[model samples]
Target: MEPNNDFEIFLVATPGLEAPLHAEAVEQGFADTKPVPGGVTCRGSWPEVWRANLCLRGANKVLVRLGGFPAVHLAQLDKRARKFPWAEFLRPDVPVKVEATSRKSRIYHAGAARQRIEVAITETLGAPVSSDAAVRVLLRIEKDLCTFSIDSSGEPLHKRGHKPAVAKAPMRETMAAMFLRECGFDGSEPVLDPMCGSGTFVIEAAEIALGLRPGRSRSFAFENLPSFDPNAWSSMRQQQPLAKPDVVFHGSDRNSGAIEASTKNADRAGVADFTMFQTRSVSDIKPPSDAAGLVIVNPPYGARIGDEKRLRSVYGSLGKVLQTKFKGWRIGIVTSNAGLARSTRLPLLPPGPIVDHGGTKIRLYQTGVLT
Candidate 1:
């Protein structure tokens, strides 16, 4: 495969977040970005694929389509797979993990299809197949057409490889970045999270403000590909000069353990200089600066109604504190329960698209600059 050859690059997004991810892709200058059901598709070469994994904060995984063929039976699939130019993209020494999914097609046995592809790669391409390999080859046999792609991102982008500590039901960095975008935070102004868990939102805001790339400290699966150029990748990963922001991002929680975790995570992320985490209750929280910005919080809510009812007072206290202390700052509250959001009684606009945080469905209830 040519290093500059253009192909389909699929950016897997959290369900219900395709639009925001598409918008982020467009902003990052990806070619022909279009939002689909579970992801956004674009066309780019190998360098673009590497850059996508390196820079796109909202993408969960980046996949590059290798090639495909119409195969109706197992024999045809095996034949076509054996002829695939895998050596051009994959190294013989690198172990590869193959996974297959079949939908609405005659070749409905996913396990059988996966076995065939694995055999083809092992025998024809001379690459060992391992279930635990960092490099992944995905085969989707949909509608009798087999499409092969390589997962360019080894681990999920949200991992960031820096945060080792987390609070209960902590928000993911990818989701937090998109939600910050949805809240109209451009990283110029301060961001305060009163119920900050693990300091995800606060640290993310600080990083954005500092113009830091989310994947700067992590390694990607693309490094194992034959097309990878070490010198070029090293130059690309070299971070540009970053200027310190004038505003400081703030996070506060009642739990001292959460505060400690947030501090450690921030230091690891290299944004501790621009962030402040305090062990304080919602009612004790105060703005860090005179300038008005965004106060975004993902308050805790429960699955059971009784737990939800008990949390109403907590939500009410949060809303009351914000109303009394933060006059001009806008607010964004994330919760699974509409009732808990209603308890805030802030002048909220329509809630955003439902986002799947782990397994729970949550929405961002946003407000304009508060009165």
Candidate 2:
């Protein structure tokens, strides 16, 4: 495998939400876009990889495909790994972590494969192999072929670096952004979340509408790569100036603590002016008068033993409020229990794919404009 000037950028996606991620890559003007099972792959330069980390909201992580070759055994893999031009992508001073996965390959022992690559990087490139290294080199061996990639995002893109406050089972920023995309929000319309745990949905929506880069407040693994040009990256990052949002976003919760957390989070995100959070129950929620947009909520499903029954009243009351109000506004409800969503009696369309939220399986149920 030889390092080249051209390469593929793999945008790691949250499983079951590949469609929205794929759509996002295409919309963001990435080239040769294609969707795979766990992520989306596109072709670009190193700078483009940097841009993907900063811009794409739906991407969980960004990986740069280094190269690949065929290897039938451990000896062949070790020999090839050493000759793969580790210097082209890795520096001798920085540490790296090598991870390997094997399936349907002659080199079935992933641990041994990882050991070989770690030795190769250490001996050939003079780089230390640390378990806690931010720079990760991933090796995937399938059908006697080995492909290598570098994780350009050190921290998951969801961190966004600004949101320190979170609620129990708060939705990852990546997942929240995808759901907003699935709901057809293009940043021009207002968004509302009644049960906005830590205001994930509300903050994400405000960022999108205002053209704020998710990576603006964070650092990426690509900064340490051999090919990275700090001046060029700085120029690229500063080229796109922020824009003011035309419409305001809203988030409310019955818990006063949740409201306080959301307010602090929104202010830290620099979207407090364009967004609002308040301590209010679902039944008291009211739509803004100016614009009709999407209402999205990630409510608790109470999937544990005897928990669903207790949550029925919450869903029922939420439905009553939205049905009578919020005309012409789209709605999306994310919950694990289909029974709980049905109790709302809102005209929900077919469910989206089952997504892994922490450990529980959840799906998004949407509706046409509420009549």
Per-model clash counts, in order, read: 0, 0
Residues forming the 10-long window of minimal summed lDDT in candidate 2: 301-310
Query: Any residue pairs clashing in model 2, and if so which?
Result: none
> TM-scores of the models, in the given order?
0.97, 0.97
**Candidate 1 global TM-score:** 0.97
In candidate 2, which residue ranges exceed 4 Å CA deviation?
1-3, 304-306
Per-residue alpha-carbon lDDT of candidate 2 for residues 86-144, written as tens digits (9 for 90 to 100): 89899999999999999999999999999999999999989999999999999999999
Model 1 Cα lDDT, one tens digit per residue, 1-371:
32448989999999988988999999999999999998999999898999999898899999999988999999999999999888888999999999999999999999999999999999997899998999999999999999999999999999998899999888899999999999999889999999888999999999889988899988999999999999989998895558789999999999999999999999999999899999999889888899999999998888623487779999999999888899999999989999999998888899999988878899999999989
lDDT at residue 320 of model 1 (Cα atoms): 91
Note each model's CA RMSD in angstroms.
1.5, 1.4
